[model samples]
Target: MVHVNPVQVIVDPITVLWLNAFACNLTKSLSTAGSAPAPYIDLRLEAIMPRLVLETTHDYPLQRDRPSTLQLQTTRLLVCNYRSPDPTAPGSLAGLTKCLERLQAGEMAFGSDFPARDGDLQMVPDRLVQHTLGKDHVQPAPADVVASVPDFRRDLPGRLLWEEPRDVVFIHMDPFWGDFFGTSAVRHRPVPFIDAIPVSMWVYQNRNKVASVSDGRVSDLTMVLHVPSLISLQLNHFQYLFLLRQLERLSEMSALLTLDAERLLGAAGAGSQCVSAALPQLDISLLMPCLLSSKDSSGGDLSVFPDSSSVTSFQEAGLLPTRVDSLSEPLAELGAGLSQVKRGLNSFLSSLDSALKSPDDQSDTMSVMSDMSSDSDSYVLLNLELDKSESVDPLFVVEGALKRVPSVEIASEVTEDTHSEVSLSSAMRKRDVISALTLRLGRVELVHQGAGLSSSLKLNMRHFAAEQCAAIGWDEFQAKFQLRTKGWQGLDVSSPPCSVRLRMDSTFVPVANQRQHRINIREQVSSELEVRASELELALLMSTVTNLTDFIEDEILPVPLPMELYLEHIKLRLTEDRPPNNITSPGVVPLDLRLPAVHVTRDGAGVFTVQQPTPGGAGAGTGPSGSRSLVDVASSFNNPASGSEGELGRLRRRCQLLEDQLEQRRGSEQRLSQLTALEARCREAEDEVLGLREEKEVLMKTLSYLKQEFLRLDTAHSRRTDAK
Candidate 1:
C-alpha cells in the first residue's frame, strides 16, 4: 500500500498546441472583455492578434478593404507606426487615414522607431483629414463635444463629419523601437488637428514644429511643447516669435500648454531676440531654462542691440524694464571732482614733458603761475574774518593764513663747498621771509612752516666749522635781516627786534687765564640767562604783572645778576654823593638818596633804560661784565656764598665736591698699589733670570771638561791598536 508507482505522462503536439491557443484566447478575452461586445469578440481578437505580428515585421494588411459589421461594433485601438513609405509621394498619409476610416476607429495613436528621422507623425492624420474635409466642405466639431473636453487636457474632440480623419490623440515616437523612417510629411504645414479635433492633445518625441500650428486653431489645441526638440529644430527668429504668439493665444483660450524640454528653449542666432521679447508672456514656471538662464534677463544689457528703438520697444512691451540711474548727489560731485583733478594732473604732466624737452619753454610755467594766481584769489575769497571780541590768538590767525596759501616747488643749484651763487625762486624767497618772521616772533604755530627753512639753513651751516662762526655766531643769516630785506620789510615795524644780551659782573677777571676763564664764565652766564628767560616768559603769562616792560626790568633783568652786584651797587650809592638832579626841593633834603637806587626809567623815545653805578665808585664794576653776570657766574668766579640760597646750600655743594674728590683719590690709590705689586713681581723675575744664567755657564764648563777627557781616551785606544 505504501509503494507508489511513478506515472509516465507524455504530451502530444496537437494537444499542446490546443492548450496554448486556449490560454492565449483567455488572456485576450480578459483584456478586452470590458469594452468589447460578445458576438464581435472573435473578429476583434483576430484584428488585435494580426496587429501584434504586423508591428514586429512592419508589414501591410493583406486585405485593404473595409472591416465587417461585427468588427465595426467592437472598440478598436489602432496603433499606426507612421513610417512614410515614399517622401516624394503626394498624399502620403492618405493610406493611413483610409485605414482608420475602414476600421471605423474613434481613437488613433502613432509610434515611431527612429524619432529623429520619422519626425512628428501625430499630425499626419490631422493634416490629411483637413485636406479631405476642405474638399468635401464638411462642418467642424459641435459645441457640445468641444465643451465636454476639459481645458487642461491635451486632447481636443474629433470633428462632426464621419469621413474626416480622426485626430491621432496619443503618440510615442521613441527611436529605441526601430530605425528611422523619414522627416514628418506635415512638419512644415499647419497642424490640422486643431481644426478637426476640439479636445485633442498631441505629443511629439523627436522634433517639435509648434510654430506650424495654424494661428486660428491655436486656441483650441493644448500643446506639450518639447523644448529640447524645439531647439534641435533650429527654428529662426520668426518661427520662435510665431510659436510664442500661438502659446499666448492658447493661454488666452484656456487651453493647457506644457513644456517638456529639459531646461529652456535655448536661443540660437536671431532667436535670442524673439526669446527676450516673448519671455514676459510665457508661463515661467514650466520654462526651467528661461527661469534659470535668464532670471535677470529683464535687466540684461540693452546696449548689445544695434537699434536703441528696439530696446525701447522691448521695454514698452513689458519684456524688459529701463534700469533706474541711482547715483547720490554727493558721490556724483566727488566723482566729478576726481575726474577734474585727473584731467588737470594729465595736462600738467604733458606740459612738464614739453618743458623738460626745452629749458627755454616758459609757456607751461606761465600757465602754472596763472593757475596759482587764480587759486590765491580764491583763497583770499575763502578767508574767514575773525570776531574781534573773541580774543583770538594773532599767531594762530597768521598760521591759518599761511596754511591757506598754495604750496610751490622751489628749484635751486646751490652746492656745499663751492659757493655757487644760485638765485632763489620767488616762491623760495617768499617762504624764507615767512620762516624768518616766524622764528623772530617765536610762535609755536609757525614751527611747521619754518621746518624746511631751518633744515636748509642747517645744511648750509654744517660745511663750516663752529670756530669759524665764533665771531658772528649764526648772525650772518640773521632772521631779522632776512625778513627786512625780503618781502617782509613792512612786518619789521609790527614785530619787535629779537635782541638778547648777556651782561657779566665786572668783579671776576683773572689776567693769567683770562681767555679760558672768560669762556667758562660766558657759558655759565648763558645757561643761567636761558633758564631765567624761560621763567620770565612763563611768569609774564601767569603772574600779576600788568606792564611787561616794568616786569622785565624789575624781575627778569635784575634776577639774573649776582647778589654781589646788587650789594656792590648799593655800597657805591651809599658812599657817593647824590646827583644834583635827584634833589627834590630845599625842604625835602634829597630824601636819603643813598638808599639802594634802582633808577628804572623809560627814555624820551619810550625805550626802557636802567642806570648803572659809576665804574670808579664801584671797584668790582670796573672789570668786564661778561664773566660774572648771573648766579652761576658768582659761584664760578666770585665767593660761593654770593647769590646762593644760603650758607647751608654752599656747604652742601662743597661737601658734594669733596666727596667726588675723595672717590677720585681712592681710585688713584688703588692704581698705585697695583703698580707696586707689579714692580715686586718684576724684581723676582729678574733674580730668577740671573740664577738661570749662572747655571747655564756652569753647564758649559762641565761640557768642555767632558770633551777633553774623551779626546785623551781616543788617543790611548789608538796607541793600543797600533801595538796589536
Candidate 2:
C-alpha cells in the first residue's frame, strides 16, 4: 500500500501566497509616520540642502525616496570601477588602480565598501540597487545605516543602531563607454537611455584557505534580478515592443556581469589550474509596481484612466486634475498598438527560430559568454518568474532564450589518449548545461488594466569533475507543476486546473576531460497529469455549443468529469552492454503493464464510484456505490451531516439531502462570480493604497519647496508688522 503525502497537496498554494505577501510587504512605502515603525531616511536633511549640493553628493539620484526596493543577503565578491569628470585630475585613475592591486594581492576585504577609494573621496554604501524606473519613478535610497533615538526613549538615552547589510557591489562606469564596455554585445536603444547602467556581480569564493589545487568546492550560484517596471509597461501601448527591447538590454547586462566576474575571479586564482567559475543560477523576478502613476500607465504624456471605482475615489479625494469622458480614441490606439506588438513579436520569434536552426560559424563565443559561461566542465541554470495579482502567464523571453541552447564546451589542452572512447563531439552532446527546467504560467491579459498576476520559480544546476564525481550520486526526485487560469479565452474551449507530476532518480558520470555527463537511457521515469472540471468557461464556446446541439445551454454543468493520465514507468535501454558480431536478434524486451483504475464523483457530496476497466479498450465499468472515492478522503471541508446521517428520521433526512444539494449547486455557481467581484474590489483597494503611498512620497520630495514657501511668508509678515 502506498501512503499519500498531504504536504504535496498544500505546498504550492502556500508557497505562492507566502511569496506574494512577502513581495507586497517588500514594495510598501518605507516612509511611514510612526515611532519605531520601520527603517526610514531623514527628510529634514533634504529640506535644508540645495538641489545642486544633493546632486554632487554620493548616491545622487537614489538618495532619498525609493519604494520599489527589495533586499538580499549572500556572500559575493565585489569588483568596482568609476569615471571622473576631470580626466586630468591627480587621482583620476587612482581608485581603479588600487582595486586592481588589492585583487592581485588577495588582500581584498569583503567588508570594504570601495577598496579603490582613498580618504579624500566620500564613502558610499556597499550595495547594488537596480532600477527599471519610468520618467516619474523615484530613485530608491541607498542601503545605509544610521543611528536613531525615539522621542519616547529620549529619557533613557540609548542609541538604536540599524544595520542594513547587502552583499552585492555596484560599479558605476562612464556613460559613454560605447563599445569599450568589455563585450561585443550592443544595446539597442529605441527610447532615450539612462546616463549609465551600473553593473552588479554576485561572486562565489572558495572558502578553504589550505585546500589542494583540485580540491576546490563549487556551489550553485543564484542571481536574482528584480524588475518592477514590467507591470506598468503591460498597461501601456508598446508593452511587447518594450519587453523585446528590454530583453536585449538584459542580455547585454548579463554578458557584462560575466566578463566582470571572470576578471575578478581570474585575478583571485579562481580560473587557475584548469578550474573555472561556472555560469550563475539565474532567478529573475518581474515584480509589479505598488503604485500605477499617470506616467506608468500612459507611457509618456496622456493617461488612460483605470477602473471606475479608482477614478471616482481619486476625483473625490481631489487628486485628479481633469476627467476625460471619451476612451474610444485611446482604446482604438491601444488596439492598434496591441496588433503592432503582436506582429513585431511574431517577426522576432521567426527570426530567432531561423537563427537557431541555421549554423553560423562567424558568431563569436565571447558575446554569448555573458549570459552563459564557456568554461570547461561548467553548468548553467535559469529560472524566470513574473508575479501579478490577476494574471500569471508564461514569459516568452525565457522560451526564446531556451530555444537557442548555448554551447558549454571550452577547448582544453589535449593530451594523447588514443584508447579513450570519449570524443569532443560526444562529450559536448552528453554535457547537460541546463540540467532541469520548470515553467508555470497563467493567462496573460494585455488589455485589462485592473487584472494582476503573481508568480514564483527557482532553478538549480550542478557541475561535476573527477575530484567531485565521487560525491555526486543518484537521488530520488519528486516534483509537481501546477497551472491555474481564470477567464481564460480561446476558440470554443474551456480551461480547468491542470497539474503534472514526475518522480525519478537521476545520476551523472564524469567523462572526457573530467566533465559531467548525463546518463539518460538507464533512468526510469514516472509521470502523471490530472485535469478537473471547474466553473471557468470560455466565451467562444457558447455559440459553438448552441450550433452543435439543439439545446442552447446558458451555463456549463460542473460535472464530475475529472480526468487523469498516469504512466507507471518509462525507460530506454539495450538488452546487452556488449554483443557478439553475429548476433541475429536485436534483443528487446516487452514492457510489463498493469491495469489502470478509474474513479469519478457522481454528485457534489464527495461520493464516487470506483470502477474497473472493461475489455476491448472500453471506458470504466460501474462499481459498488459504497466504495469511498479519493475526493472524499482528500476533502478539506468538514461535513457536519456525515457519520451521523443514520441518526436522523426520514423527514429530517429528506430535508438534509435537499439542503445539501441546493447548497452545493449554489456554491458552485456563485464561487467564480464572487471571486471575480472580490478580485475587482481588491484591485480598487490596492489603487487607493497606492494613491496614498504616492501622495506621501510627493510630500517627502516637496519638503524643500514647503520650507521655501514658509520663509517667504515669514518675510512678508515681518515687513507688514514693521509698516504698522
Candidate 3:
C-alpha cells in the first residue's frame, strides 16, 4: 500500500499557473539476457508534492513515482461543496446565478463594452451583486433585461475541495476577500480555470471562454512590465500599453529611432550623444523576442541572434544597416506629417473652444453647427504585423535539441550604494563564443499570407550588450550578477541584453464606431489638456482597434484574456498605497500639468484618478462630445479641425515651473552624456600621464649617475693636470 503525501498548491492573483507533471519509465538491457522489460510511468496529480523542503543542495531529482504506471486510468471527478457553491467559488451554481440576475437587471454592470487594454488594466473589479427575494418581497421582472451565463472550471486540481474523498483541487477564500490555496497564499499563483477551457479560448468582457480565430480576443492575456519605482503607471496603461503591444509599436519606434540615431551619429560624435530624445517615455518592449519573420513562401531558419552569441548596439543589432538607412526619407516625412496634423488639430480645437466661450458664440450655435459640416471622418487604427506570410525563423533550426536553461528566481534589490567597491576592471572576462554567434538582423521584406502581414523579430544578445555597456551605465550600475550556468541566458527587458538593433512599427487602420465617443475641448485649451480633462475616446478607440488587429494576427501568442468576465472580478485590490516617502530616486519629481505646476515627490504606484472641474451652463448641458454644434462640424468636415490660437493674455501665461522641470530632465540627460565623454578623456589623459611619469623616473636615475661620473672626472682631471 503506497501512500502519496497530500500535495500543496497555490495560484497567483494576477496570472494563471497550470502544473503539468512529466513522467517516463527507465529501461535498460539485462546483463547476459534479453533486454529488460520496459517500465511504464504515468504523470498524475498523485505525484505532485508542494513545499517539501529539500536540503540546501543541487542536482536534486524529484524521484516521485506515478500511480498509474503502464495502465489506463479513470477520469477524475470533482465533488463541489456549494450545490449552492460557496461565495468562495468564482462561478459556481449559486454564485453565478446571483451575478447573472444582477447583470441582466442592469443594477450592476459587466462593463465588457469598455476598452480591454485602454489604459485601465488596473481597474478595480466590481463588487458581487447579491439579492434576497423573500416570499413576500418578490418583484416583477423588467421586460428589457437580458441575462448572461458565467464561466467556470470543469475539475479542481490537487484534491483541494473535498471533505472525505473528493477531487484534488480546492480553494479556500476569505469570505468576501482574497483566496488561500494549499500551503501557498493565493496572491502569487491563482488557480487556472481549466476543463472547459478550449485550446483556442480567449478573454472577453471579463471572463475566459472558448474563442474562435475570427473572434478578436486580446493577445497574450496582458502586458507585463517592471516599474523601477522611477516610472509611473500612466505609461503601463496610459500613454500606451507596455511590453504587450510589441508588434504594433516596434516598427514605428524603429523608424523614429533610426532617424534620431542617424542625425545624432555625427553631432554626438560617437563619443557624446543620446538615443532617446524625441520619443520620450516610449516603451517598445526594448528587446522582446518575437518570431524572426521573412517574405519567402516556405518557412526557413531566420535567427536574429545566435544561441551562443549576443548583440552590442542598435547598429550592430541591425538598426543602422544600409537598408534601415534607406528608410530615412520616409520616416522623416511621416514624423513631420504626424506632428503637423496633431498641431493643426489642436489649433483648430482651441480656436473653436475660444469662439464657443464668447458671449455671442452661444447665440449663433446654429451657425457654428453649419460651419462644422466640412470636417473629415477618417480615424486611424494601428495594425502592426510581421510584414509577410508565415515563414520559419532560422534561429529555431539549432537541430537535434534546444539549449537547456536552468530556472532561478529573479528579483532586483536596491541597496544604499554599499560594499565600498572593488577593482573589478579585471574581475570580468568576455565570452568569445558569444562574439562568434553574432548576426545582423537587416532584412526588411513584405508578408502577404497567413492571418498574416505583421512584423517579426531577430537578435544576437551577448555582443550587443558588451558593446553598448556605456549607454547602459555599466560602470556605476553593475549589480551582483551570479549564474549556475546551465546555458541560462536572458534578454531581460528590465535590463536589456548587450547588443541588438530594435525595430518597432505600428500599422494604421480605419475604424468607425456607431456609438459616439465624447470629449469637450474649448478654443482656449490645448488638446493635450482636453485629453487630461475628458476621456480620450479617440485614443481608446485607436488602441482597441490595434489590439484587436494584433489579436487576430499572429503577432501575439494566442490565449484567453486574463480576467474573469464578471465585472466584480475587476475590482481587484493590490497592496496598500502610501505616500512617496519610501522612494529613493534623486530625480523623483511630481509636475502638475495644470497652472502653477509644482514639483511633488511621486512614487511608483502614483496613478490615481484626478477629477477636474468642467465648464457647466444653464439649461440641459452638452453631452460628452461637448456642444452638438462642434460634433456636427467635425462630422460634416468628415472630421477635420479648424486652425490657430489667439494671443494668450495673462491667463495664458507660460508655465515657467513646468518649463524648469523639463529643462531639468534635459540637463540630466546632457550630464549623463557629458560624464561618459569625460570618462573617455580621463582614460586618455591617464595613459599620457603614466607614460610621462615613467620617463621622468628614468631620466632622474640617469642624471644621478651622470653627476657622480662628473664629480669623479673633475677630481681626476684636476689631479692629473696639477701633477703634470
Candidate 4:
C-alpha cells in the first residue's frame, strides 16, 4: 500500500529559487509513467519524504500538473515578499495577486519583508505565521532594525500591495498615533476620503472619525454602491452621535446613509454646531434644558454634554435668557430686616458675655443665696404644719377636749409608782401603735411578695389606689373593708370547691358498699359471659354444619359413582340407633353380603367388581365373583337428560354446536354476497361483448363497400388509358 503524508514547507528568500527548481524536476519525473523502474528506486527509501517548499514567483512548481498517484501533498503555501518599482502605483499588487491565484492548493498566506529598506515601512512580525512555521524557520531581522514600530506608522496596505477587489475593508486607526489617512491632522473635520471603496462593509477601528461628515457635504459626496446588496458602515460611540447630527441637518438625505452603531452610549458629547444641527432633527426645543436638568438632578459630570461652546451656542440661538430681572423694594426691605435681626442677636450675646465678667457678680450671688434661704424656711414651715395635721387623730382630739370639761376632771391623788407605771404603759401603747401602722402600710407589699405578683401589676394597683381612692363611694369602701377583714374567714382559697367536694366524697364513702357494688357487678358480668359463650357455641355449630354441607355437595356428590352408593352412605349414617357421637361404638361389623367395589383411572375408565362375602365374614371375598367395566355406566350418563350432574355437560356441548352452525351460516352468507357481485360483473361483460360484435359487423360492411369503390375506379382508369 502506498502512503500519502501532508507536508508543509517554508520558503524564504535564501531557498526560493533552488526549492522551485527541485519541485519542478520532481514533478516532471513523477509525471513520466514507467520511465523509472521500481527496482531502481527502493520503495522503502523513497517513502522517506522531505518538505516541498515553493517560491512566490511566476515559475513556482505548482503550475505544472503531476500524476494522481504521486504521494506528495502540499500542506502550506508561503508567499514571499514581492516589491514593485513604483510603490504608489496600483499595478504593483498584480504580481502578488497572481502568486496567490497560483497557490490555490492549500492554506495560502501572504507576508512582507520586515525592516523594509525604505524607512517609511514599519516591520510588524506576523505572529500567526511565526507560531505556525516555527520561530527558527521564519527569518529574523538584523540588529540594526528598530524593534518598536508604531501601529499608525506601519504601511499595512502599501507593503502587501494587493489592491484587488475586497468583500470587506478593515480600516484600523490608532488613537494615540497618527496614520497616513491624516485623521489627526484636522481634529474637527470628518474623514471623507475613506468612502471611495464600494465594499459591502466598511469597518473602522479605535475611533469613528469618518462619521463626522456634515449633512450638506455628505449629500454631495458619493460613497455607497447602488446595488441591491445591503451596504453597512460601522461606527463607534462618537461617530454614532455625529451621524445622528448629520441626519438632523439633512433629513432629506437620510435614505443615502446606512449606519450601524455598536456600543452606543446613553448620552454623548457634541460640539455647538452638532447640537444646533440635532435640535430640529430630534424635534425637542428644550433638549438642552432637559439635559441640564438631568445633569443637575443626577449630579453627573458636565462633560457628558458638549464643552462650554454648547452653552454659548444656546444663548446665541436665543433659547436662553441673556439677563436676570431685579427684585422689588419690599423684598429688599425684608433682606435689610433680616440683617438687622442678625446684628441685634450679636449685640445681645456680647452684653451677656460682659455681664458674666462683671465684678458685681458677687452681689448677685448673695441675693440668690438669700432668696434660696427664705424658700427653704417656707418649705420647712409647710412640712411642720403637715406633720401637725397628720399627728392629730380625730378621736384623740375629741377625747382630749372632753377630758378638759369640768365633768371630766381627774383627781391629783395618784402615787409616784402609779404615775411611773402609767407612763410605761403609755410608752408601750405608742410602740404598738407604730408597729400596727407599719404593718397596715406594708400589707399589700407583703401580699405581693408572697403571691408571686408581677411588678407591673403591683405598680398598677398602687397607682390605682392613689389616683382613684376619692372616686369610691362610702358604701363601696365599707364593703371592700368588710370583705378583707371578715368575709375571708369561711372561704377556702387554696383549692377549687368542686375538687374539695370530690375529695370529701372520696373519703366519706363506705368501703363495704363499694365491695358489695363490685360483687354485684361481677355477678352480672359473669352471667353475660355465660350467655355469650352459649351464643358462640351455637354459631360454631352452625358454621360446622355449613362447612360439612359444602364438602358433601361439592366433593362427595360430584364423585363419578352411582347415585345409589351416595344414598346408601347417607342411609347408613341415619339408621344408627345410638347417639351420633356413639355411632362408632360397634366397630368393624362384617356380613356375608355383596357390595360393589369401584376404582377409577386417569383415562376416565372405571373398574367395578361385585364382591361376594365369605362365610368367615371378611370384608374381601376369597374368589373373584364378577368383574365389569364402567363404560356401560358412562354411556348411560352421557344421555342429555340423564341426571342433574350430566345436565351442565350436555348444555355446554349444545352451545358449542350452535356456535359452529352460526359460523357456517355466516360463511355461506359471505359466499352468496360474493357470487352475487361476480354474476353482476359477468352480465356487464356479456353486454359489452354484444356491443363489440355489432360494431365489428358495421365496420366489415364499410370495408366491403370501399373495396367495390376501389375496383370501379381502377376500371375507369384503364379505359382512359386505352382512349389516350
Candidate 5:
C-alpha cells in the first residue's frame, strides 16, 4: 500500500506560489512506471480564499500510451444587490409583484386598438393619439382605480419603456403643498424595486478529442456554458442580459484561439516563405466587410431576439416574462481586437507574397542591415501541407516541417574581414529540437508558381482612441520586414535555399503619450536561438530600438520626423558587400561609404554615430578626384577664370549655389508665414482692446447719468420725508 501526502495550497489575494511546488511533485510522482492505481492527490486549501483559482499546466509526451480524458466542471454564482432610493416607500413582496403586474398591463395600454362607435369611418395614425376624455369613455379599470398604486412603470411615457436607461434614476420630490400645484405634469417617480437577483452559471468542458494528423496531432475542444434561466424583477434585467451576452462572446473567442493553437504557437514564423500553393491564401480585403457587418447606420444593430413585438405580446398576456437577448455589441468589439491581430498576420502574408513575386527586392547597397533575419530558420523554406480540411478552418492549418537541404552557408570573401562560413545546418544541429524527430510536417509542391505578380497591401488606419487627447492608437500601424539570402555553397540543388521571411507583428494596439506615463516593462522572453548569438542579438536590439523610436514619436514628441525618416521604402545592405562607387585612386579611403542613417561602431569603446553623407563632388571635401581644401574653394570664388574652371565645373558651381539659395528661401518663407500669423493675432488683440475702450466710455457716461438721477431723487425725498 502506497500513501501519498496531501498537496498543501496557500492561497493569497493575487499570486499563487506553492501550486508550482505541488505540480513538480505530482509530475515526479506521475512519471514513475507503475501498474498500481494512480495515487489519489488530495488538495488542501490552507489560507483564506480570495476569489477562484483554477490553473492547469500540461506537458504531454510525444506519444501517449493510452488515451486520457479530463473532465472539468466550474459553477459560479453572481448576486447583485441594490437598495431603494426612497427608504420610506413600501417595498414588500406583494407590492413588488403588483408593480410587475402593472408593468405588464401597461404594455397593452398602447398596444390595443379602441373600437369605433356607430361604424363610423375613422382614420387614426399610431403616431398621434387623443388625450381628452370622450362621452363613450368607460369607468377606470380596477387596476388603475386602486389608491395604493405602485409607481413603477406609470411615470414613464408608455412608448419609451424599452428605451429607458438600464439603471433607473430615482428623483426625490419634496412633500411641499405648493410644489405639487406648480407643475401640471407632476411625475411620481417610483422607489427602485427589489434588485437582489442571483445568477448561476455552469461551464462544462465535455467533449475534447486528440487525433493524429500528417505532421502533428490536432485537438478538437468543445465547451458548453449554461446559465440557468434568470427571473429579472423589472430592474437590472438589461444589465444582466448584457453581461451574459459578453460571456457568450468571450467563450466563442476563446474557442477560436484554442482551435487555431498552431497559428498562435508559430506566430514567430508567420512570415515564412509561401512556397506551398495548397495552403489557403487569406483575402485581406474581407476584413472591412467582416467588421462592417457587426454595425449599421443606426449606431449599432441592437435588435432583440424573438422580436420585440412578440416579447411585448407575451408580457401583456400575463405570461412568464420573456427573456429578450440583446445584440452582440461586445462580440463586435472583440472582432475589432481580432481585426488588429489579423492586420499583423496580413502584413506577414503580404510580405511573403511580395518577396515571391519580386526576388530582387533585396539589393547589395552599402547600408547597415536593420533587422536582418540571420537568426533561426528565417531564410529556410517551411513546407506546409493541409490535412483534414473538413474539420479545421483553412487559415489555422499552419503545420509544416523544415527542409533539411545543404543549409545556407555565408560566403567568407563577401567582406574584407576574414569571417568563417557558418552553415545553417550546423547551427540547427546545435539548437534544441522540439519533437522534430517524432512530428514531421508534410511537403507541398508548386514553389516556383505565381512569379512577377503584383502583391500590394491596402492601408486602412483606424484611430481607436480618437476621443483621447494625449494618446493615439492605430489598428494598421504595422512594420513588415523580409530576410535577405546571403551567399551559400555546398548545395546539391541548383537554386539557393528559399529565403524565409518571418514577421513578429504586434498583436495589440499600443497607447502612448498620456499626461502621466508610467511603464514598468518586464520583457521575459523565453526563446531558443538556432543561429549565432551576435546575429540574433543584433536583430532583437534593432527591433527594440524601432519600438523605442515609435514610443518617442507617439508620446514624447509633438510631431514625428519627416516622411524620409520613416524608412518605409529604405533597404539595409552590408557595407562590405557594396564598396564606394567612385574609387578612382588606390589607398584613398572615402569619407562616406553609403552607411546606414544611424551606425553603431564596435571598437574598444562602443560608440553610436549618425552618418550624414555629403553631396557627391570633389569640392565637397569627401569624394574622390579634384581634391581641393575649403580655402582653395574659397579662393576659386574670387578667381572665376582659374585653369580648373571648365564648363562642367562652372555649371556644377552654379547649381550648388542655386541649391543653397533655394534652401535658404524655403526656410525664410516658413519663418515669414509664422511671423504673419503672429502679426495677425497681434492686430486682432489691438482691435479688441480698442473696442473695450469704446465700451468703457459708454459705461462711464451711463454711470454719470445714473449718479445724477440718484442725487436728484435723494434731494427730492429728503425735503418731504413725511409725504409717504
Candidate 6:
C-alpha cells in the first residue's frame, strides 16, 4: 500500500474553537517516535467550560421537554516535538523543558485567544438554562443506556456540575510499540469513526469529532439545522456577503419594507401581487422585537428576548464592539425588526378597525389571514439551537517548537532488543501532566510526534456545499448532536491495535413547541421502524400465507390461508354468477375475506317460474259444483288466492309420510353416533399405547448405555489394579 500524509485539510478553517471548561480531565501524555507504525499517537483531550447552549433535535423524534443541550466529550490527539537535533528521536516528557511548555510560555503565538463570546467569560453552569418551550420534543435517553451512567439520575437535580477540558485526545494506535502481538493483516484497526457515524454536526463539537473510521473509510454525513437555527446563521452575515442568496434577500427586504407611503400603508396595490415577496432578503434581526413580544406575551418563555439592559448596543463602532459577534448583535437586529413590524402591523390593524366601523366600508374579513406576522419569533427561537453549536473549525496554527532533547545510545551499546514486538505496548501508555491558562478564546494549534508517518493512519472525511445539499425532509431532520455513547468521552486500549465504538443519537429536537413536539415524537418512532426494516432487509425474513379462503382471522394460528385458496373461492363465485362464455382464470378476483354467511341473500329483482297444483281432496274446482279448480284457475302464480287446494292436500299427505321416515332416520342416526363414539375411544387408546411404546424404547436405550459404561469402567479399573 502506498503511504501518504495523514492530513485532511478543511476548506473552511475556524470551524472549531472553544475554551469552555466544564470538566477538566488531565492525563499523562504517552508519546514516542519510531519507524513505520508508531508506538503511540499522542491523543489528548483538554477541558474547557462547556457552553450552556440550546440544542434542537432536527426533525427527528423528540420526547416531551428534555434538557436540550449538546454535551460534548472529545478524544483529541496532538503532535509532539523534541528539542534534540533529530526531531524523530524518542524524547521523555519527564519534567525536562517541554515543547508545549515553551509555546505556552510565549515562545510562540497564533491567534492569541481562540474565538469565544467576547465579554466576561461565564463559568460553565453559573447560570440557569431557562426558556419557554411549547412542549417537550426531546426523547429521554434509552433506559438501558441511562442505567450505567452516574450523571443521569431519575431526577436531574441541583446545579449541573460540568468541568470539561478545552478538548481531549483520541487516536487508534499501535499499543504494541515493542511487542509483535496482533497482526495488521488479519484484523484491521478498530475504527469507531467508520462505525460511529458523525451523522449530525454538533456531534463534531459535543463528541469532539466523531468518525466511523473502518480499516479505511469515512462515511458521508451532512450537517443539519432546524428552521430556527438556520435563520440565526443567515442573520449572522448581515454586514458582509459571506454567503449568497440570504444576503440578497436581506438587501431586498431592507429596500422595500423601509418605505411608509400612504398608498403602501393602506395596501391599495394589494390584489393578485405577492406580499412579502422580498422576504428572502429581509434582515432576520428586524423580526425579533415586534414578533417575539406579541407571541409569548401570554408571558411564556420570553427568556429568548434579551433584556434591554442586558442586550449590548449594536453597530456603534468601538474596538470591543467590532469584535463582539456573539448572539447579541444578531439578537439586537432581530429585536429592532420585531419592533418595526409590530408598529407597522399595529397601525395597520388600527386603520383597519376604523374602516370596519364605517358602514361605507363593507370589506371581507377573509383577506387578513394571508398577510401579517413576521419571522422574529422563528428567527429568535432558531438562535436557541444555534447557540449550542459551533461552525467552521480552525485546524491549523503556525507554531513550530520543540520541548525535549533525547540522547540516543549507539547500536553497539544496545544489549537487549527492548524494541522487540513483545514490549511495544509499554511505550504507548507513557503520559504527562501539564497546565496552561487562556487569556481569551480562539483556535489554538498543537502538534505531537508520530511514527515516521509511513504506515497509513488517516481521519479523512467528506465535505459538501451546504447550499447545494438536499435535506432529509423536515420530518427526518434533528438539529442537536447526540453522543450515542454517553460519556463516550475517554477510552484507552492495549493496542496491538484496539478499537472503540462511538455511538451517536440521530437528529431530534431536544426541545420544541407543542405542535412541533408531536411531529418530532412521531419521527423517532419512524426512525426505529427504519432501523428494524434495515435488519429485515439483511436477515431476509419472509412470510407465507396458507388456506386463504378460510377466513378465521386466526392470528398466530401457526398458519395462514393460501392466496390460491381464496382465489379459488372468488373464482367459483364469479363462475356461478356469470354465463358459461365468461369463465376466466381465478387470479382476476381478489380473495381477501372475513367470516361468511350461512345463506346468501339473493336479489329479488329477477324473474322466476311457478309450479301448478296437483289433483287431490278439496280441489278448488269441482265439476258442476261451486268449488274453484285451483290447478287450472291460476295461470299466474303471482296471485295468492287462486292457489292449488288439491295440491295442498297432497302435500299434507306427503308430509305425514316424511314424518314416519324421519322417525326411522332418527333411530339410524343414534346407532351411527354410538359407533362413532366407539371409534373415537379406540383412537384414544391407540395413541396412549403408542406413547407407552416410545417411553419403553427410550428407557431401553438409557439402560443399554449405562451397562456399556459400567463394563468399560470395570475393565479400566482391573487394568490399573494389575499395573499397580
Q: Write the residue-wise lDDT of candidate 3 on 1-724 in tens digits.
A: 1334544332221121111101001111132356453222221222212222111111112111101011111122122212223654332434434433422332112233212112212111221122122121123433443343332233322332322211111222111111111211122232111111101000112222133122332221211111111110111121122123332333333333332333333322111111110111111111111111111212211222222111333334322222322443355455556556654655565455644464453333221112344675643322121212134332222211111222334444421211212111111212100111111111111111111112222111112111211011111111101111112232224322222222222222212431132111111111110101111001111112233343334433433221101010011111111123344623223222222111111122333222211122111121333223444434535733321121222124346656888999999999999999999999999999999999999999999999999999999999999999
lDDT by residue for model 6 (46-76), tens: 2222112212223211211112122222222
Instruction: Give, for candidate 6, the lowest lDDT window spanning 10 residues.
Output: 528-537
Q: In terms of lDDT, which candidate is strongest?
A: 2
Cα lDDT over the full model 5: 0.25
Model 6's TM-score against the true structure:
0.13
Question: TM-scores across all candidates?
Answer: 0.15, 0.18, 0.17, 0.13, 0.15, 0.13
Worst 10 residues of 2 by lDDT: 464-473
Error of 1 at 320 (Å): 85
lDDT minimum window of 10 residues, candidate 3: 193-202
> Mind giving the per-residue lDDT tens digits that candidate 2 earns over 541-583?
1111222242222122422322232221222111111112344
List ranges where model 1 is wrong by over 4 Å.
Answer: 1-424, 427-660, 663-667, 670-674, 680-684, 687-691, 694-698, 701-705, 708-715, 718-724
Name the regions of candidate 5 deviating beyond 4 angstroms: 1-660, 663-701, 704-724
Residue 266 miss distance in model 4 (angstroms): 99
TM-score of candidate 3 on Cα atoms, chains taken together: 0.17
Q: In angstroms, how far off is 377's CA in candidate 3?
A: 94
For all candidates in order, the CA lDDT equals: 0.26, 0.27, 0.25, 0.25, 0.25, 0.24
**Which digits, one per residue and each the tens of the lDDT, describe model 4 over residues 1-724?**
2443544454343354345445555645565654542221112111222343322222212211111111112222121122234634221333223322322211111222111111111111122122223342322333354456774356333323332222111211111110111122123223221111111111111122244233211111111111111111212122223333332333211111111000111112111110000000000000001111111121211122111221212122121111100122233355556556654655565455545554453232221112445446432111111111133422211111222223423455432222211111121121110000000110011000000000000100010000011011222322332333222232222221110000000001123433224222112211100000000000111212232343233211222321111000000111111112353454322122222232211211234333222221221222243222355456546864654555566577779989999999999999999999999999999999999999999999999999999999999999999999
Instruction: Give the residue spans of candidate 2 off by over 4 A.
Output: 1-189, 192-630, 633-638, 641-724
lDDT of 3 at 73: 16
Better of 5 and 6 by lDDT: 5
RMSD of every prediction:
55.9, 30.7, 38.4, 57.4, 37.6, 38.9
Looking at model 3, residue 82 earns an lDDT score of: 23
Backbone clash numbers for all candidates listed: 14, 14, 90, 0, 1, 125
